[model samples]
Target chain A: MTATLGCVTLSLADRLTDLTLSLHEGEVTAICGPNGAGKSTLLSCLGGLVAADGGLVTLGGRLMRNVPVQERARSIGYLPQSPEIAWDVSVEVLVSLGRLPWGDAGAKIGRDAIEEAIAAMDLGALRNRRVSRLSGGERARALMARVLATCPAWLLADEPLANLDLRHAIALMRRFREQAGKGRGVVLVLHDLATAMNFADRVIVLDRGRLAADGEPAHALRSEVIEQVWGCKAGWLGERGMRALSLG
Target chain B: MNRRLILILVAALVVAVPLSLLAGRVWIDPIAPTTRNAALILFELRLPRAALALVIGAGLGVSGAAMQGYLRNPLADPGLFGIAPGAALGAVLSFWAGYAASVWLLPVFALVGAGGAMALLALIAGREGGVALFTMAGLMIASLAGALTSLAISLSPTPFAMSEIVTWLMGALADRSWREVGIAAPLTLIGVGVLLSAGRGLDALTLGEVAARSLGLEPRRLQARMIVGVGLAVGAAVAVAGVIGFVGLMVPHLVRPLTDRRPSSLMVPSALAGALLLLVADCLCRVLPLSGGELRLGIALSLLGAPFFLKLLLDMRRGLA
Candidate 1:
C-alpha cells in the first residue's frame, strides 16, 4: 500500500509549510535537506510518530490516525536516528522484538525473518553478543536488522548511515534498494548526497520546512536547485561520476 | 541460561528461608523442638517476619526493575518517583493525628498518600515527559513529602509519639505477624503481576518513546501500568515494613549481569535476589552484636547499599572521564 501526505503541516515552534507527496510502493525515496529543513519532521509526520498541526497523512487510502497501532506497526517499520538501547540484551533477542506485533504464530516465519535480517546485515557472528558491547557501527546494523525483521510494507529510517563504515553503508544502501525491488517503500533521511544519487529512485528535498524539490535524483539534484536550496555550488566531475557540492 | 539462574535463585531462597527462621536470638531447633517457647518463637515471630521480608523484597526488586526498564535507567528505583516517601508521610500523618493505634488505618492512609504522590508525579511529568523531567519532579515531590513528615514529627503532642515515628522511619520487620503478611500479600502480588506483564512494552521502550509508539506500544498505557504497579507494591511494602531502602535500587543491578541485562528477564531474578538479600539482612540484624536494640533493616540495607552506590558513581565518573 502507498503512503501519502496531503498538505501536512507540523508546527513545533517553527512552521513546516504544506507538504504534499505520494510515496509509491517499490521505490526508494531519499529525503535530503540542509539543517533545520524539517526533513526528519516530515518523515515523522508520515510515519504517524508525531501529530501534524494541520492536514492529513494516509496509508493505503486509510487515515493514518485511524489505523490501529498494531496493524500500522506490522505494515510499517520505523527506525529513528540514534535509537537508544537501554539494556545489554543479545542481538538475536533484540531483533526478535520486531516480531512482537505478531503474537504466537508458528515460530518458523519469525525465526526465518530474524535470521535473514541478521544475515543481511552481516551480524551473524555478533548475534549472541550483548548490544551494549558492540561498536557504534555494529549497533546501528543490529538495530537496522531489527527494523528489517518486521518485514513491513513501508520502511522509514532517519540517519541510519550515520555511524556505519563505508562498506557497511554501501551494503545498507544496497539492502534498501533490494527492499524497494521487493515492492516495499523505503524512505530514508540521508545527508550523503552521493549515496542518495547513486541508490535512490526518487529524491525529496526540503528547504526551510518546505518541499523545495521532488523528482528523479538527477533532476532534483540539479546544480541550480542545489545552489538555491542548499546555498551550495554543485558540479559533476571525474569518470567516477561523483557529484560534489561545496558551500558557496 | 535463564533457567539456570532461576534455579540458583530458588535454591538460595530455600536455604535462606530456613536459616532466617532458625538464626535469631534464641536458636530454634526445627528438627527437634527443645521447648514450646522455641516452637512459638519459630511459628509466631520468625515465620511471619521471614515471609514479610520475602514479599517486601520481591515487591521492591520487581518494582525497581520495572521502573528502570520503563525509565531506561539502571539507577531508577521504585522510590525514585517518591512513592516510598509519600507512604512514609501518610504513616507519619496517621501517627501525628493519633490514629496509630488503629491496625488498618495506617496502611490505608499510606496507600492513599502513595496514590496522591503518583497522581502529582504524572501531572508534573505531563504527556511527553522524559526521564529527566520525571526524576526531577519525583525528587521535588519526595522532598516536599519528607519535609511535611518532619513537620508532623516535630509537632507531635507526645515525645512517645515522636519516638514511634522515628522507629517507623528507621524501618523494621520486627514484631510483624501473619496479619501484616495478609495486608501486604495481595497488593504486592497484583502489583508484581502487572509489572511482570509489561515485559514486551518495556523492551519496546528501550527504543525510545517515538519508536516504541511506532511499534504500536502505547507509552502512556505502559507508563500508567508501571505507576499503578509501583504504587501498589511499594505502598503496601512500606505499610508493612516502614520504608525499607535500597533493595529496589540494588537488587536489579546485582541480577542484571546474570540475566544478560534484558529488562524483562531481570524481573523474576531481581525479585528473587531481593527476597534473598532482605532475608539475609534481617538475619544479620538479629545476629550482629549491636550496643543498642536490634539494628533496623533499612539502616542495614543503606550501610550495605551505600558502598555499592558509591562504587557505581565512581565507575560512572571514570567512564565519563
Candidate 2:
C-alpha cells in the first residue's frame, strides 16, 4: 500500500508549512534533518498520532483521518522517540502489548509474532528479564521488538537509534532493511547522515520545517545541498561514505 | 510467583476472618454452638463490622492501584487526587443538611462529591499535565473541600450533630450494622468491576500515552473509567468508613514488588492486601487500650500510613537527585 501526505500542515508555535510526502512499500526511507526540522512532526502526522491543520493523508485510497483508530493502529506501528516503559514488567509481557489492538484474537496470532520479534531483535535471552533492568541499548531493542511485534504494514519510528551503540545501531538498520525486503514500509527519523547514506534506499531532507530535498541518498546528500541546508561543509569520505566536516 | 502470592494472601484472609470474629473486646467462641451471647456477638456486631472492613479495604486498595497506574506515578491515590476528601465533604454536607437520617443519602452524596472533585481535578490538571502538576491540583482541591467540611461542621444545627460529624471525620466502623454494608457493598463491587475491566488498557498505558493510543487503547477513555470507578468505590468507602487514610496509597506499593509492576497486575493483589491491612487495623483498634474512647480506624491508618508516605517522598526526592 502507498501512503501519501498532501499539503499537511501543523502549527506548534512555529509552523510546519504545507509539507507533502509519500511513503512506498518495500522501501527503507530515512528522514534526515538538523534539529527543529519538523521530521518528528511529519512522522507523527503520518502515524495518525497528531492531526494536521490542513491537508490529507490517505493510505491505499482510504483517508487516514476517516479510518477507525483500531484499523489505523493495525496498519501503522509508531515508536515515539525515547518511549518510556512505566512498569517493571518482563520483556515478554511488554512485547505482548503490541497485539492489544487485535483484541482477544491477539492470543492466537500474537504468539508467533512475539516470538519472531524477540528473535529478530536478539532479545530472546532477555525475554523474561524486567525491562527496567536492561541496559540502555538493550531497552531500546526491547522497545523496538514491541513495535515490530505488531507487524504493521508501515513502521514509523522517530529517532529510535538515538541511544544505541554502533553494533546495535547497525543491527537495527539491517532489521529495517529486512522488514522492507518483506514488503513493509520502514520510515525512520535519523540524525546520522552516514548511516542514512549507507542504508536508506531513499532520503528526505528537511530544514527548518520545510522539505529541502527528496530522492535517492546520493542526490539528497549532495555536498552543496548539505552545505546549503545544514549550514555545514560535508564531503564523501571513501570508506566512511559521507561526513559533515565543519560548520559553515 | 504471582499465583503463589495470591494463594498466600487468600490463606491469610481465611485465618484473619476468624481472628477478626473472635478477637474483639468481647471474645466469642467460634467452636461452641450453644452460647446465645456468642451467636449474638458473631452474627450481630462483629460480623458486619468485619465484612465492612474487608470490602472497604478491598475497595481502597483496588482504587489506589488503579489511580497509580492511570497517573503513572507511584504516589497517586484517591486521597492524593482529593477524591477522598471530596467524598468526605459530601458526607459532611449530607449530615449538615440533616439528610444523614437516610442511610442511602450519605453514600449518594459522597459519590456526587467524589465525582465533583474528579471533575475539578481534571479541569485544573488537564489530560496532558505531569505528575507534579496533577498532585498540586489535587492538593488544592482537597484543601478547598477540607475548608468546606469544616464550615459544615461549625455551622451544624445542634451540638450533638457537631460531635457526630467530628467522630465521623475521625473515621470509625464502630456501631456499624448490615445497613451500612448494604449501602456500600454493591457500589464498591461495581466500581471494582469497572476498574478490573480497564486492566488491559492500563497495562497498555505503561508504554505511555502516545504509544498506548497507537496500540488502539484510548487514554482519555481509560482516564474517565479510572476517575468514575475510583469515585464510586472511594466515595462509598468514605461514606461508610469516614475518611480512612493511606490504605489505597500504601497497599499498592507494598504488593508491587511481589507482582509484576504492570499496573493491571497490581490491582487484585493490592485489593487483597488492602483488605488484610484494614482488617488487622480494625482489630487493633479494638484491642489497643485507650484511656479515653476506642481508637478510631482512621487514626490508626494515618499513624501507620503517614510514616510510609514520608519515606516514599524521601525516596522520590532521592530519585530526582
Candidate 3:
C-alpha cells in the first residue's frame, strides 16, 4: 500500500505546513518530533481525521477524501495519542468495539478476530476484566487490542508507546514490527528518538509544523538533524541499531 | 444478567401496566365492571395517561443514554441540550398567549420551539462539530430557553395564567387524553429509533472524538442524529407532559450495572426501566393520600433523583476512603 501526503497543509493557524511524504506498506514508519511539531496533526491528516487546507492524503493509490468514512475506517485503525475508555467495560468489550467499522460491534465481534486481538495484546486473562481495574500499561494494551481487532490495513497510533514502561514499550514496538512484517502499514507518532532509531524502518522528523528530515532512522534523526530540529546538543551513546540519545 | 434484567423490567411493565390502570383514585375492580362510567374512565382517561407516561419516560431514558454516551459524561442529560426546556418555553408561551385553550396548539408550539432550538444548536456547532463547542452550544441554548420560560411565567397577563404556567411546568401526565398520546408516541418512537441506530457511534466514541471519527463515525452525523433524536424525544415529552426531570439521569445509572455497560446496550433497558419507573411513580402519586391535588411527576422524580445522587456521592467518597 502506498500512503502519500501530497504537500499536505492545514489552515488551523498553520498547525501543519506544506509537508509531503510517501510511506509504504510492510514498513514501521515512525513520525518523530518535539511537541507542537505537527506530528500528531500529520498523523491525523493521514488517518483522514483532519482535513487539510491544501494538498491531500491518499491510501493504496485512492484519494482519502473520496473514500467513505466506514470504508476508510475498515482500512485504517486509529488510536489517539492518549486513548480514553469512557465506560468501564470489559477489555473484551473494549476490543470488540473495533468491529464498529464493520457494523458488527459488541457481541458481533468475530471469534477469531477477538481472540487474536486479545492474544496479540497478551490480554487473555484480562479479557473479562473491567478497564477500571487495569493498570495503565494493561489499559494501553487493551486499547491496542481494540484497534487490532479491526484488522485494519493501516494501523496508525499517536504516541502509542508514550506512557509505557520499558518492557511494555519494547513489547508494543515488537507488535508494531509484527504488523509491519505482515505487509500492513504501521505508522506511529513518537517523541522518543532512541526508540524510533532502534525500532523504526524509517523516521520522519518535523519541526515547527514543517518537515525537518526524512530518511532511514540513522540519517533522519542523526546528530546534525537533532541539533537543527530539536535545538538540543545531543549525541548517540550506543552504536548502530541499539543506539540511545545522550545529551551534551 | 443483562438479558435477565431486561426481561425483569419487561415483566415489571406487564404487571405494572394493569396495576396502573387499576390503582388510580377510583380503583377499578377487574372482576366486575360495575360503575356506569368505569369503561369510560378506564378506556378514555386512564389508558391514555398510562400510555403517555410510558412513551414520555422511554423517550427521556433513550435521550439520556444517548446524550451521556455521546458527551462521554455520565452527568449529561437531554434537558441540558435545551430541547425540553425549549419545548417547555413553547408550552409556557402558549399558556401566556392563551393559545393553550386549543387542543393542539400547545404541543404544536412546543414542537416549533424544539425545532428552533435544534436549528440554533446546529448553527452554533456549524461545520466544526467539536464536542466542547457542541456541548457549550447546548448549555447556552438550555440557559436561554430556561430564562425565557421563567420570563413567561413572571410576565403572565393574569395570575390565573401564571398559575397555569407554573402548574404545567411542574410536569404531569394527569388528564392527558389519547390525542396527546397520539402526537407523542410516533415522534418519540422515531426519535428512539434514530438514537438506537447511533448506538455504534456512541460506543466508538468511548475512544474520544478524533479516534471515534477515525472509526468512521462522522461526528456531525452523530451530532445531527442526537439533535434530531433528543429534540424530538425530549421535545415531545416536554410538550405533552411538561418539564419532567431526573428519569433520564437516573434510569441508565440504575440499569448500568445490570448490562455490559456499553452505551448502546444501555438505551433499550434504560428505556424499559424509565417506563417502569414512571408508571410506578405515577401510580404512587395517584395512590398517595396527598392534601395537595396530586404529587407532580416532575417533583416526584427530583425527590428520587436527589437521593440517588446523594448515594452516588457517598459511594464515591467511600471508594476514595
Best by lDDT: 3
Candidate DockQ values, in order, are 0.76, 0.74, 0.85
TM-score, per-candidate, Cα-based: 0.94, 0.92, 0.95
Report the candidate with higher DockQ, 1 versus 2: 1
| DockQ of model 2 vs. true complex | 0.74
Summarize candidate 1's per-residue lDDT along B1-321 as a digit string, tens digits.
888999999999999999888897787777887866887898899999999999999999999999899888877788888989999999888886677468888888888889888898888875865657777888998999999998999998899989988888888999999999999999999999999988888878878877887788876777778878898899999988898988988999889888767688899999899899889999999988788779999989989889988887887688620
Q: Say what the RMSD of model 2 is.
A: 3.2
Query: Total backbone clashes of model 1?
Result: 0
Off by over 4 Å in 2: A1-14, A104-108, A239-248, B33-36, B99-105, B122-137, B154-160, B314-321
User: Which segments of model 3 are wrong by more than 4 Å?
Assistant: A1-13, A106-109, B313-321
Model 1 Cα displacement at A185 (Å)?
1.0
lDDT of 3 at B198: 89
Please, what are the lDDT tens digits per residue for candidate 3 over residues B18-53?
989988888889999776699999989899989998
Better of 2 and 3 by DockQ: 3
Count of residue pairs whose backbone atoms collide, per candidate: 0, 0, 0
Chain A agreement with the truth for model 3, given as TM-score? 0.92
Candidate 2 per-residue lDDT, tens place, A60-119, comes to 667677879888888888899889898778998888888877764246578988898899
